[model samples]
Target: MDAINLVSARELARRNGLSFPNESPEYRQARDELLAEEIELRRHIERVAEQRRALPPGGQVRKDYRFQGPDGEVTLRDLFADKSTLVIYSYMYGPQRERPCPMCTSMLSAFDGEVPDICQQVAFAVVARSPIERLLAFKKERGWHHLPLYSDTTDEFSRDYHAIGPDGGDGAAYNVFTIKDGVIRHFWNPEMGFATADPGQDPRGAPDFMPLWTVLDTTPDGRPPSWYPSLTYGSGP
Candidate 1:
């Protein structure tokens, strides 16, 4: 059988054997329609990924930016390691702030566990504008031993990559770079930010990268507008 286009989403949803207790006909009808839409949404995600993979080569990275990692100083090219693909997450942890951005920290915390598996296919690093010691200390405090943290001490990388705003504030950025024949080039980065957010929605890239947001999006509550992740949650009455 062909990998795709085997069956229509509506047909698949209708054939589902799942039935909940005390479900009315009205609910079932609406649920079946929703399931069909969900199936279509999954297919659309795959299509978007395929197109992204087929994109033409991005801008070449000519400058030799330096960063301070746990193992000492390293260049941007050094980040590729043995892998042709490199993924760097520019976290909001600049020296100006007493603490890192909670949202960025939350996202990185989730990535900590997935680092091992993800590194199998790509070299991944979490970069910040703070000093190496501060970055490492925070990593340890977060118990993120698997994540490879780095400090963009000079702000060269962050500035060039648009990870830092013009106001000298830090922001979250996920960038992918490709290396071939000793030449490094940018691959992809989501440009969506607060400016691109719809009237009632928070700015988020398609196929959201954060697991917390993804999970919350599936619930009936559907990611409350005011709800956000916090660095520490106290168990108070």
Candidate 2:
């Protein structure tokens, strides 16, 4: 849709007749105004996604990185499977840590349910710098049946993809790759990080992927400043 030809968000919001049982005039007025902004926010999100889809082909894969999957070993190209596009999420789980990153695990918990749907379009996999057995054990513990877990035992892929920091610590990373004409190439990844973060805000990618934050954003309280997810909550997994 062309923005130039679209109706104004304010006009659309004003035309909206949605009302609650006990909403006052003041509440309705403010809600309509907020609705207009929400409409614009939706459009901006689509605009950004369109821009991303229009990005030119990215760099080619330099090394033949290997990973240990449930079945056996696999290479980067093999990750694509039968699809042309592949999505790899590098979680913060390494040999040194007794548990996986709470944030990453929280995000993946949501993703586990969506993997089946996501894989219908593009291949998706989760890679971590832990042994295959350890990764699978955690998967079983979390009851994530659909998420494809792999171990980056050699750390080659993690090191090249920024999952392994210069300090040798594990970091969360999301990357996309595409295969064309028998050649695999990088697609896109969130480039914003600590260096690019706005003052007083933690570094985050546009259209945040975490559903936890997205849901919280709709509430009056929003996401708390210091609050974070724990591996287990109230003695429950």
Candidate 3:
């Protein structure tokens, strides 16, 4: 069988049956152009993911990092359970902070519902520097039921994964690890930081993990420059 070539994004858009009745010609033209760009962006994201999956073997994990969970002490290897992949999201809730980072809380809020489905393919856990009791209390207060919360009681995991700065400030970090043939190794992380951010944009990891900013981006006002998530707000409407 002869291999068929894919059509250009613009051609694909032109051939699509989607239509909005009573829409102006200008709107159609603009929409079609945007559609093509969206197609290209989707392709680019796939390419980047492919590249990530093709990365060479990452650094070997030498330390047996321990975490405090509701069930008691669990090691780094134990987090993987039966899955080969493990995703750890380091929430910015350290012992010194009176409250957790609103940004991390917002992201975790979204993840709470996804944990069940996500865990089907890979093990997932949220780690923080706070005590296990405090972490669990906040988890309950925020109404998060599915997200597995753990405490990096000794701060080693946080420091090793760059979740805590040299000065001891907490930060949000996402890291993936792989366990193969009884060997645990680092996989990939979004190393982008404040210093590498583009002008007029906040420092964001590639493929922005949070859905909040992605949803806000569709608004006319877009994401506010000064506005950010808050730990608490006044009484509900």
* lDDT string, candidate 2, 1-237, tens digits: 599998999999989989999989999999999999999999999999999999999999978899999999999888899999999999999998988999999999999999999999999999999999999999999999899999998998998888988799998999999999988889999987899999887788887999999999999999898899998888788
Residues 1-237, model 1: lDDT tens digits: 234656998999999968899999999999999999998888888878888999999999999989998888999888888999999999999999998998898888889889999999999998999999998898888888798889998898999898999798997889999999988999999889898888988889886888998898789988988988888889621
TM-score for each predicted model, relative to the true structure: 0.94, 0.98, 0.96
Better of 1 and 3 by lDDT: 3
Which candidate gets the maximum lDDT versus the true structure? Answer: 2
TM-score for predicted model 3 compared with the true structure: 0.96
If ranked by lDDT, best first, what sequence of candidates would result? 2, 3, 1
Check candidate 2 and list the clashing pairs.
none
Give the best candidate by TM-score.
2
True-vs-predicted CA distance for residue 86, candidate 3, Å? 0.3
Which sections of candidate 2 miss by over 4 Å? none
In each prediction, how many residue pairs overlap at the backbone (N, C-alpha, C within less than 3 A)?
A: 0, 0, 0
**Model 3 local distance difference test score:** 0.92
